[model samples]
Target: MRPVLIALPVLALAFLAGGLALTRPVTVPDTALAGLTGDAIAGEAVFWAAGCASCHAAEGATGAARLVLAGGQRFASEFGTFIAPNISMHPEQGIGAWSFADFVTAVQEGTSPEGRHYYPAFPYGAYRLAARQDLADLWAFWQTLPSADTPSAPHEIGFPFSIRRAVGAWNLLNLHDDFVVTGELTEAETRGRYLAEALAHCAECHTPRDALGGLDRRAWMAGAPNPSGSGTIPALTPDRLTWSEAEIAAYLNDGFTPDFDSAGGHMVSVIRNIAMLGDEDRLAIAAYLKALPPAGD
Candidate 1:
């Protein structure tokens, strides 16, 4: 019994050490920000492509009001309610004081300037796949937006979910910076893949997650229950969509189906964001969706 007790404590210590290692933050290389030059005009397009306003902007805001990224939007999940932080240009209430490296770390590595791990709710896993040039341009454009003095609300998460270090372990299993599909894709397909997988982060919503919240890549783009636990998010696989390429593009651009059905729910904002893209981009996205292998419900 004495020997067994000693061995048990040793095993417990070892387990604790392993968990700490798994949660360790990755180092951000200084070269990530080197030689980065950004254009505010170009950044505006990147901003829309990344769909920043969808989460950061005020709910139901329209026209010029949509540009205010004060971030009071609440996202409820099985974990708990997460309040979006203020990302506006305000020096105190927002990220105005952050440096280029800080932004890069937050977006790509899911680490804050103070070296805290961000919850996966921030979607850095997808943003990690974004091109460095695009991130630079997006940051530049974000700087041009007007600042708001709104303060951010704290997230209402509890217990295990509230422990940010636990998220590092989750990242170990789920986080990666690679494109979902591999092969010699055409130019349009490649562009669409980047837009869909990286910038737009479509899988963050469309693809169902395992119990641990990791995306089920085997069932890629197969619709899942809304993360909000409200309604079913429709599948976008070719088997389910069945729309012609033109119809797909039209739906993305105008939010209207060939049957004259209008988009609703979360898709309304998604359509609005994609509509900001050029016609070619819309067509490319449609082409990519049509080319994908179908997954069943």
Candidate 2:
């Protein structure tokens, strides 16, 4: 009995130690951004394409007001409601104080400057594929943005879901930088793939997720159920989306479908951001969508 009790305590200690190691934050090296110069002009395009304003801007903000990233948006998921944090240029209330390495860690590795894991709601898994130069440029552009002193709201989560450390384990399982669309060819399609998969994170919502909340890549862009439980998110695969490339490009540019239907729901917000992009970019997105294999194939 004495031997059994000793072994039980030893096992418990081992388990605790293992958990600590697993949850340790994964960060980029301080030298990761070394020698890389940031260009704010290029980053402006990346910012709009990534739709940073969609989740971080003040609710109901319009026009140039969208540039103010005072994040207080609420995102509901199966786990809980996650609030977008203030990412404005405010030194205290936002990421203005973060170094380029810190931004890279947060955006690419989903680890905060304080070595904490961020929830998947921020979509770093997709953002991880972003080019290092783009990240540097983004950081440069971030610095140029107007400062907002809006404090971040805490996420409304419960129990195990609220455990930020557990997110490290989740990252181990689901976080990857691989391109979803393989066997790509055209230069335009390649560019489009990067835009859709990395920057815009179209798959984050357009694709279905597994029980653990990781993307089900097999169904890639086949659409998914709305997390709000209101209705289904439409599939973007060739199986369902048969729109012509020209029509798709037009829709992205002006929010008008082939049938003259305007973009609605959350897409309206998405279109607002995409509309700011160059015409070539909209066309690239269309070409990329046209290149995808039908769902289930």
- lDDT per residue for candidate 2 within 136-186, as digits (tens), equals 888888888999999999999865566676666667668776888899469
Candidate 1 lDDT tens digits, 30-49: 68579999888888878888
Worst 10 residues of 1 by lDDT: 1-10
Highest lDDT scorer:
2
User: In model 2, which regions exceed 4 Å deviation?
Assistant: 1-20
| Predicted structure 2: lDDT | 0.84
**Candidate 2, clashing residue pairs?**
none
Error of 2 at 192 (Å): 0.4
User: Any idea how many clashes model 2 has?
Assistant: 0
The ten-residue window of minimal lDDT in model 2 covers 1-10
